[model samples]
Each structure stands twice: as structure tokens, then as C-alpha cells.
Target: MSLLQTLPSLPSDAAYDLVVIGAGGAGLSAALHAAIDGAKVLVVERTAHVGGTTAWSAGTTWIPCTRHAKGVADEDSLERAARYLDRVVGDHADAALRRAFLAHGAEAVERFEQHSDVHYRPYALHPDYESDVDGSTLRGRALEPLPFDGRQLGALFGLLRPPIPEFTVLGGMMVDRTDINHLLSMGRSWPSLRHAVKIVARHAHDRLRHPRGTRLVMGNALVARLLHSLAQRPRVTLLMDTQMREIHVSDGHPGPGRSIEAVTLESAGTSRRIAVRGGLALASGGINRDPVWRERHLPGIPMDWCPGAPGHTGQAQALALQIGARHGQGAASPTFWAPVSRRQRADGSTAVFPHFVMDRAKPGMLTVNQAGRRYLNESMSYHRYGLAMQAEQCRSEAGEPGAAAALPSWIVCDAAALKRHGLGMVRPGGGGLAPFIADGYLRHGATLADLAHQLGMDAATLEATVATHNRHAEAGHDPDFQRGVTAYQRNIGDATWPGRNPNLGALTAGPYYAVQVVPGDIGAAVGLQTDDQARVLDAQGMPIGGLYAVGNDAQSIMGGTYPGPGITIGPGMVFGFLAARDAWRRCRSA
Candidate 1:
């Protein structure tokens, strides 16, 4: 049964030991942690479904020194991870929070595995984004959620948010990194053929009974596990379609001694007041959609570019700010960014597909600015690529006569690359290009010159750029940007390619294609200041009693630097776990 139907109603006084706002990874983690500790917890979700942006993500978490990484990374330690963070994130955020995450990340993983339904396994090949940084490892720091059978969730399975349509295949079958590889090589290898056929058959069977595939993977699985654990906890109450209106503190003035007294919530067009006995954990994704916040921090980017769930309206952050909960300082960027391509779906909704590792870094592909010149390495992390776009756009906006803008940058690929690597929303194997071209989402040309003209760029410049790339590619090196020099870059490149460089190949084939990409804010980096224990802090750096923030609602421990896979989700879950324990401690003290 759905938790909403099974949960008992709140008492007449509407009192609870803890209240968690937002039902994303962090909020769910906080609520689950509290519930496992025997606290009466109430989880408020504005959206009908749980799992915020996390649900749409790849579901990788970068937690160093976890039990899952024991045999995989004997050299890994908190000190080594700290050094990498110091090199990449240095002074952009509180070091204490980083330390706290490093120290307790393993414990948090262990706790959830032992006491809840959540489970994870260390990735064998996932590498940190900043492999060039000191003390970085090629693997063992990243963990992915083990695929879960959504059938186990039964009716409650409907509560989990579905994966982005662009990320799925055959209507609604979710595929992980391994599945994609196996599916792509099914025709060549018998084992791969068996695996692909098995999954496809399973998904086909599921279509008859379930709305989507019952075999959940990635972020969907992570959320399903958390939801399953919460369902088993009788003390937990999950309220969907509930919006928090106001946060009532213990005083009229904002002070360090302030405590959460109650909160006003609106649900189904009715407003009600509820009492809080322990603490309030704010995990409402982030402020990415807030108009003022967007204008102030993410200028020049359209609000529609953000692929995160709509629940992150910043209402909770604004409410927290009203009580003097100032935003954390010194983040390298206000928001974590990714390059995304947009297409109009048949349902009239726009699909904002993030271009991470699927195409750009592969052989025979290249990214170019409006001037039709390569700006940054194509193999760089999505976060770094987005940052580069913003930098180039900023330079162009400064009115330099010939400065090229990176906004609306085009990723150009030859026919081989288009078929093997797939460009943006275009799937591999090159079967469905007509619809995308008709919709203006994909542009193709008989030659590089024709492609450039179609994209409204100077043909001569684009031809020259392609010639230069091909020259370097033939030599198996990209000296200009060093595309595949890093371990992380090479790992994502085509491993089966017989070329001199897996990430490089001559773009000389006919029928070149291009797709436009814009920088997208995947999550927030700047958020309410919080202490090491996840307590929200006042302007004076004093902890505000009974108030906590996690997920995107709290300043990221990475300081806006994407050091590795799952930086955001890893710290989010860790801090959420800490916030719940701290809240429970306060309850016992009271």
C-alpha cells in the first residue's frame, strides 16, 4: 500500500519529533535515518512524487573509504580524499563540513545498509572528475545503487518518480552503463545478446502489468530502496502534495538561540499548523528556479534549461533566509552545471537531456562555438564543460568584436561518430534522424561546409577547424586541449576503437551532423550556511537550534567543484544522515 494511505493521521496537536521538507535523496535520507532511530517523523513533499533531481540522475555517489570500496581501493583513505578536495575545492567552502562528510560517509552507508533497504556497490572503473588533482584515484571512491525490483514496492512503486524519458529505452526500460554496453554489442557477443534479450523480454512483460519497467536502476532504484525502508518504519509519515508556507521559530528576532516552534503547511487547498518538537531538516533540492536567485546567480541561462524536478522552487530557502539564515559564502559557482540538449516530446513537454559522456568525447566528434572553433576539451567533465561555456559566453557578452559565444554551442560529429557514439538525444545506430531533423533538434549536412551553413556559421571557419582537428586526430593527440589525457576522459571514451586514440578520430566521413547544447543548472551549490553537524547557522556563524539543512538546501561540501562522480548526492546523503542524528540527539536532550 502507499505510505500515505497506511500512515496514521497526525495527533490533534499535530506534534512531531522531526519534520523533513522535500522528499529528494537528502530529505528521504534524513527522514529514513530519523525513523530508524524511533523518532516520529513527518516528511513534506510539495510534488506528488518523491526523488527530486536525484531521481533523474545517474545515481552515482562519490564516498571514499566505504565498506564497498574495501578490497577495491586499499590505498584509499580519508586523508587522500581530503587532499584531492583541498586541491580542487580549496577554501570555497567550510573545511569542517568536508571533514565531516569524509569521516562519516562510510558510517552513513553502513547504517542505511544495515538498518534500511538502501544498498550500494563500488564501481570498478568510475574515476574522479579531477584525476589531475593530487591524491585522486581512478576508482573505488564511487558507488552506484544496486538495481531494485520495483515489484517489491507494490503499490508504493507509484510514489517513486520516473527516470527521464531520454535516459530510457523501448518506451520506459531504464539502462545502466553496463546495460548500454551490452545492448550495443548484443549482435557481436553471445553473452551480450543473452543479457540484452533478457532485459528486453523482462521489460516487455512488465509493460503488461506496470506503467514502466519493474526493474529499476540508477536513481530510481536508490529512491525505491529508500521508500521501501521508510514504508517499514511505522514512525515515519510521508505527506505528498504538501507545501510548507511559513517557518515559525521561537522568537520574533533572528538569533543564535532561536529554535523551531512550528510550521504552517498547505495541502489540498487547506492550511494547517503543526508543532515541531525536535528539528526541521530543509532538503528542498535548491533555489535554481527562484526568479530572483536565478537572475542574481545564473544570469543569461533560461529557467527552462534546468532539468531538475520542479519541487525545488526555493520556497524553503526563502523562508529560511527570512529568519537570518544567510547563504553560505565562497562557492566557486552558485550552481552545478551540465551541457544539455532540448527537444519537444510528443507529449508537448520539452526533454532537457544532459550530455555527459555519451558522445562528445568519443572518436570522430568535436564541439565548436559559434565562430566554429573548438574552445575546450571535449573529454572534460560535464561540470567543467558547462563552466567553460559560461566563461566563453561571458567573454562574448563583453562585446569583443570577434569573440565567439559558447552559449548554444554545437556538437559536431561525423557519420561514424553519429552512429557509434550518438549525438545528444539522437540514439546510437543512426535509425531515427528524420524526426529530429524535421523538428529542428538535429541538423545534418552532406559536408562540413554544408553543416556549418545550416547552423548559421561561416563555412570556411568550420572547415578550417575540422581540418585542424583531423590533422591532430591522425597523430593521436590533441595538444590544443588534451581531450583524452586524463584517466577519467579515457575511461569514458570508446574502448573498442582500434584507432591510436579512443577519443580521437578523423572527422572526414560524409553526412556530418550537429546538435545545439546550452549550459544547464543541475543543482545548487550556494545554500543556507550550516555547521559541520548539519545545523543551520545564523549570520554570525552560530548554529540555530532545531534547524538543519541538507541536499541542495545546504551549501555543498564540495564548494561548487565537481571533484568526482556523485559529489552532490554523496555529501547530500551524508549530511542528511548527520542532520537526522543531530535532531534525534536534541530530542533526547529535551
Candidate 2:
């Protein structure tokens, strides 16, 4: 008899046309595409929720050559986008991979809007990090979600991760920076007052019904909208609290040929195997959150800024490795680092940074060590900011030898600084600044000398740095460091200042305060290497069949540098679409 006849038949319910591991933005997009194409799809997410980090993100997706740019004043071309990528990523990226992303990104973005409930509105205000680069337009390519109603999710609202409340969000509130500015400008105008009245009326109506007050904008609006769309699709089924343990491979011929047949997972305390007939797509995110991995790779720095779900470990990466999937060069994994303001939560938990600090209207101030020296430019991009924090950690380790050097750095500022820039010092719920001051996270003193002494810094040096900075503020020039050199820094700088360079201001006032700064990361950007088609490559540089990776799990196509805002999410959606399309083609050909 045949081998099939001898073997016991597998359960009828265990099989599917496509098995997608992880249900974040990338996985969700891939599954939606494949399912719409008539393939039976299964999405397994380790977390109980489906939104992943995308829920916590800014929700602005940067896409070049998009239709949203048609009537826009600024003009951009695909060739220019390609050149910018080439210049920024240089020799690190595969040329074929870059070409594939550029060719398909626009098509994928447009197609998703047409087929799904996702609304793609042109973010005319967003800018590329390097506008000097050719093809880089100030606005046009970026797209954001239109304001979505979370009430539609009903009981599923809790399953959706809420946006950072510190930043405003309102249901049915779809807006970009320009929209917000217009709102603020209108507050000063008759039209704005009327708009505000309308908003208040809507909010009052929402408050009586929902626990979380209504107006929605930014990342929260995007996730709620997408999940609402996915919920309506009969082909898409969300399996939460399900973790894949291993890849079930089918042995072929005599040689070492094998194919991924299914994924064995543990859910609800029981083991089950989900077989894949069409293909398997891995969008399970990166390995940044694994303390063991971070300790092994990035030894000195503190791991603070991960926006991914706690379940976003390297299960998918381990599975890929088991199947002989090869990783890329130049740091086996990418280091995630960001400057975080040290704040205490209402329940005495440590508050993360950027969410609390990176605002120009409300600056978190400069973070210094025990030596009273500023370690990094507070306004550097998140990627570079993390590198700077790591460098500081390295220097501390090198200096101390065996003793554990402190990881927390002090955010030095004065009362006048607080008055000029909203420091976000007051926590909600009428707490007496005790949350920040009690833990030594925020140190206050009447004089600079006292503050330096309290922070264990060289009083003379600290005083000199402040004095020098103050002199520059009076002169309307920054001699030591050009604080206002970049638009990002200036954007968050004190706008009320009369000087041309608003970011530079003298922190010369009594009752100085110092808050500790720590290392935080947005998410890991390192994973398995792939070519233009988003195909996973093995140790010998050959494609692994029935396997693909995208988003943060795939080695970044932009290399180490962040080229623009929403760079991570933009490429993620593009490659996700590419992976699904390629897999569909392969399955059809077979």
C-alpha cells in the first residue's frame, strides 16, 4: 500500500490554504490579501489582541508614488524615491530588494484602500527626514487613517490597545498636523469656535454611552478602523492567545528537500496542528524584547522603548532558524534605542519617554549623568538617540570596571524652563508632583550648584555649561551646539522665544529640577534576510520554499538609518503585499 494509506489521516479541521503567524499590521495585511484572493487563511497571534505595535504607532504610512499626490502642490517621482533609498541605505541593501519595494509599494497601498475598509488620506504636512535628497517631497507621499469610530467595536474595544492618552484622540477625528494647526488657528477665529462647539456636543453624546471618552485621531483611530473592517470579513478569523511552537515540515525525495506542512501551536492549554496547503507567511515581529537576546547582543544599554506586545518574542525567528533560514550581516539583530523622559505612572510604574517628552511645546529637558554632562542631542531621531544612549552606557561601563554604573540620567532644567516650556510635570488626578519627585527621577534644588551636588556632578562644570548656554540664549545664538540646526528639534523647541533659533534658551532660574533619562526603543528592526520578492534565504543564499518574512522581523530594507517618518510601517505594508502576491503566484504555478 502507499505511505498515505498506512499513515493515520490528520484531522479534517486542521488544514488551511494559508497559515499566517502573527496578527499585527503586516500579518493582518497579508492574510487579508490572500483571503480576498480565494485562499483559506489562518492568522495566529501570541497576544490576546490583534493590533500589535501598529496600534501604538503614529499611524502615518509613508508611500512614494501614491495617487494621493495627484492634486497636491508638491511633485514626487518613483525614481527620486529609489535614489533616496540608494543614497541612505548605500551598499548595505540588496538592489533587487529596493527595486521590488519601490515598484509594488504604491500599487499595494492603493489596492488595500480599494479592497478594504482602510481609508488612506494624504498627509500633506509630513516631511521626509532628508528633504535635501532628490525625490524627497515635504508632503504628498505619506498617508494617514481617517478618523474611525471605536464604538463600532463595542465589546471588542478592550481587545484593542488604546492610544497613548497623553496625546489627544477623538472618535471620528481624522486629522494630520496641518489639521491640528488649523484647529488651533481656528480657536482664535470664529470658524474655529463654531467647530469647537460642534466637537463638544459630539463628545458629550459619546461620554454618556462609552467608558472611554470619544474623539479619536492618530494611531488609535487607524487600528480601530482596520479591526472593524477585518471583523466584518467572513474569510478572516482572528485567533488570539494562540502561540506557535514549531514548524511541521514534510519530507520530500531522498535528498534534504523538505516543505513546511503546518504549524503546531498551544492554545487554551491544548496542542493543535494547523496545516498549510497554499503557503506560510511569518510576520511575527522582531527579537528586541527578549532580555536574553538583548543581553547577549546589546550588553550595556537598558532595554526600555519597545512598543511591541510582550508576546512578540522570537518564536517565528526560531522556527525560521530551525528550517535553516539565514540571517543578514552587520549586526545579527538591530538595536532599538530612544530617549525617554523619566515619569512615574499613577500606579507607581515607570513612565516611558517620547510619549511624554518629545514635544516642542512641552520639552522634557536635557538628560545628563552623575558628572552633570549632557550625553546626547535630545532632538536626534529615535534610532540615533538610542545609539547615543548606548554609547553613554558603554562609556560608563568602561569607566567603572566592575561596579554597576547607574543607567538613569538626569533631566536638568529650571523653573523658568518649566514656565517657558510645558514640562508635562503634573501628572493627572491631582497628584502633588510626588510621582516624579519621590523616586529621585525628578530632583529639584533652589540653585544650580545645589542641583549638581544632589546629582553627584562636578558643580563647576555643570554651572559653566548652564552659564554658557544662558549667554547664547541672550545673544540669540548657540555657540556650543547648534540646537536649532534641524527642523525636528525646532519643531519641539520653545516657540515663544524671540530669537531666530527658538530651541536655544537659557535655563537660568531658581528651583531647578532634574529628571532621570533612560534608554527606550520603538521596536527591533532586525530579522531574517530576504530578496526583492520578500523570500527568506537560507545559509547558502538560496530561497526557502513556503517561507516569507516582513515588517520588523525582516532585515530592514533601509539599513540602519531611518530615512523618513513612518519608514518602518511603509515598507512593512509594501513587502507584506509582495510576500502574499509572490506566495499566491508560487502556489498557482505549482
Best by TM-score: 1
TM-score of each: 0.98, 0.87
Local distance difference test, each candidate: 0.90, 0.67
As a TM-score, model 2 comes out at: 0.87
Q: Give the TM-score of candidate 1.
A: 0.98
lDDT of 2: 0.67
Q: Which candidate wins on lDDT? A: 1
Residue 100, candidate 1: Cα error in Å is 0.6
* lDDT by residue (tens digit), candidate 2, 475-543: 755555455666545655655566656666667667887765566666676788988877888877777
Worst 10 residues of 2 by lDDT: 1-10
**Weakest ten-residue segment in model 1 by summed lDDT:** 1-10
- Total clashing residue pairs per candidate? 0, 14
**Superposed Cα RMSD, model 2:** 5.4
Q: In angstroms, how far off is 58's CA in candidate 2?
A: 1.0
